[model samples]
Target chain A: DAGVTQSPTHLIKTRGQQVTLRCSPKSGHDTVSWYQQALGQGPQFIFQYYEEEERQRGNFPDRFSGHQFPNYSSELNVNALLLGDSALYLCASSWGAGTNTEAFFGQGTRLTVV
Target chain B: GENVGLHLPTLSVQEGDNSIINCAYSNSASDYFIWYKQESGKGPQFIIDIRSNMDKRQGQRVTVLLNKTVKHLSLQIAATQPGDSAVYFCAENPNNQAGTALIFGKGTTLSVSS
Candidate 1:
């Protein structure tokens, strides 16, 4: 089956503008998580969604929000973006909220804020 | 501010040689750890994972060693190849909770040359 898939492989947004990125989870997976990876750095968790609700969140500000649809697909929305928000946004999906379940990731969307 | 961190930022190895990447995590309660390899323009791919109860775990061409005493985690790659060159990240599930997000290290770039 096809693994997680993210849309708009790359995006360009201006400072103070908003942007939305999309993701489709793998088959039979129900949980989706978002992460931000800056250049030369590992990914930082943003939030996690299960059952169409956010179950857990990271240290990011409220400016970064997300939504998970009934189909288990997800979207990440950033409002009033700043240049510092420019980074690679990754989407990962898992079968459940189990502590030991493996996560499958998609090719991330590269956001460039000018 | 407990987090995962890597010892080295970069590693260079020759083809056919074995390579090891090291990481140190500050969360003593973490029960799960994972290693991921990310190539340019792609998302992080799972390599291997180890549980706190197990000292080591082996995959096809990769191995993960966990030293709970020193809070150390390591990834070993057998017969390094040019295609294996990528930024390797060590991640941990903080607090051993079911829905907790993973915290990742700053990653170590692996470079293999013939």
Candidate 2:
């Protein structure tokens, strides 16, 4: 009954550093997606992974990347992090690719770029 | 986490009152819509969702109404509680292989005072 799980609940990094955040999707879920939420705004989609391949991506730059393992776990990597990249990073998992599948989210990793 | 702004339009309602949070989606082709409630330091939680073919979907104490013609979506909470206070977001997706990304709108902060 475990929901999605993410690692490093909070992180502190400096400008130009790199960070990798991990996520384990819920049991029986096959798709994982990542999002970034800035203060006072809704989450902006980062990308989605399915079948161990990235299937969809948002408007973020190439410096932001992700990977999905065979077990449906995911990792979000941000290179040369900027202060603007500092935000709450969220991982969500859903069961199917079809419509009406509900997505469950984990407690996000808060990245603070100093 | 809830988005905060000195000027963020907030709906302050008594604990026992019903609450309605509204969102206007931009994509007319969006086939799936979801409502998520995000509390401080946590990721967005799925509250409810509706597909384009349906006008309404109801959960335990929540309901989602979608008006495709108007490109509007709403979440209705019955007898809102302090635990219900959070930033509510509306996310839309076309539900297709080519457009599986969920685009989110800026959320509205809902405050319920007991």
Candidate 3:
């Protein structure tokens, strides 16, 4: 089975520009979450989408937003990107919400903001 | 084939030796913990997980130990091999949050020398 898949493996955007990243969850997974990994740091949770609605969000600013399609594919959009926004964006998929489920991740999209 | 730890605290281990990676979580409410292995340019991959109810769990050659009293978690690798060299991360889920979202730790790079 195909695990999680993300598009635009690598991206370069100028300051104040907007960029969109996409992700397709693994087959049978209905929940998708986004994370950002800075250089030499751990992955930080951004938000999670379930049932086509954002169920939980981290401490990120409003510039970051996401959408989930009926087909289980998701998109992450960052507006007015800042140089600090340059990092690896990771997409993870899980089943239902609970303490028993585990998430599967994709290769991630590398975003570079200049 | 993955090298997620391009720049981080590294642990060098001799081939066939046992390895231990440590993590200390700050959230006392976190009940579920997981360990992930990430290679260069790839998303984190699940290794093992343990809940607050259990202090220890074993899977194949890997084991997870949780000390709820201390809010510490660890991953032990038996007979470490070259393929086991990767950045290891510890993630925690706050009680009811389940697997919806996870908080990750700054990752430790494992280097296996033959």
Candidate 4:
């Protein structure tokens, strides 16, 4: 079974621009979560999607949004990106919504906002 | 707000030695804890996990110990190797809700030397 996969391994955008990142969940998994990891920092929760609906969100602003497809794939969109947005965007997939579930993560998309 | 934190930012050990990474979480209600290893420019990979009900869990060459009384958690890697040199993060599931995101510690950079 394939693990989580993310697209556009790396991206560069200027301030105020919008960017989109994509993720495909692992086989047999139904939940997708997104996180942002700044250099030297741990991954921060951004949001989670299940059943094509956003279930939870972190402290991020409204400019950070996400979508879940019927196939359990996910997309993260950031509008008016700021230099603070430059980080490694990670996508994790889990089998269920419970806290006890194990999660598998993708390689992540590196976003560099100039 | 309950914050998860690490005791150390970096650790170095000989290849044949055991390494321990420590984390402290402020939330007493956290039900699940996870350890993740992230190689350079890569997303975190799940190392091991322990639930609140359990005090310890073991996986292949790794072990996770949880001290609920102090909200302390630890990951022990036996016989550290160069491949184990990476950033290690501990995350806690504050709530089992679908939207509730896992809070992660700052992370400890583990360097295994020959």
* Winner by DockQ: 1
Q: Candidate 4 docking category?
A: medium
Query: What is the per-residue lDDT of model 1 for residues B20-92, given as tens digits with 9 covering 90 to 100?
Result: 9999999898998999999988999988888888999999989999999999999999999999999999999
Model 2: per-residue Cα lDDT over A1-114, one tens digit each: 899999999999999999999999999999998999888777888888888888788889999999988888999999999999989999989876454488888999999999
Ten-residue region with minimum lDDT total, candidate 3 chain A: A95-104
lDDT per residue as tens, model 4, B58-109: 9999999999999899999999999999999999898756654788988999
Please report how far candidate 2 places residue B48 from its true position, in Å: 0.7
Q: Identify the superior model by DockQ, candidate 2 or candidate 4.
A: 4
lDDT of 1 by residue, A73-108 (tens): 999999999999999999999877755678888999
In angstroms, the error of model 1 at A60 is 0.9
**Clashes by residue pair, model 2:** none
Q: lDDT, candidate 2, residue A24?
A: 97
Going through the candidates in order, their DockQ values are: 0.75, 0.59, 0.59, 0.73
* Candidate 3 clash figure, as a count: 4
Off by over 4 Å in 2: A98-100, B1-8
Evaluate model 3: give its TM-score.
0.93
- A35-67 in candidate 4: lDDT tens per residue? 999998888999999888888888999999999
Question: What is the per-residue lDDT of model 3 for residues A64-108, given as tens digits with 9 covering 90 to 100?
Answer: 999999998999999999999999999999998654578889999
Specify the CAPRI tier of model 3: medium
Q: Which tens-of-lDDT digit does each residue in B11-112 have in candidate 3?
A: 999999999998887778877788999988788999988888899999989999988787778889999999999999988887645346888878899999
TM-score of each: 0.97, 0.93, 0.93, 0.97
Clashes of each: 0, 0, 4, 1
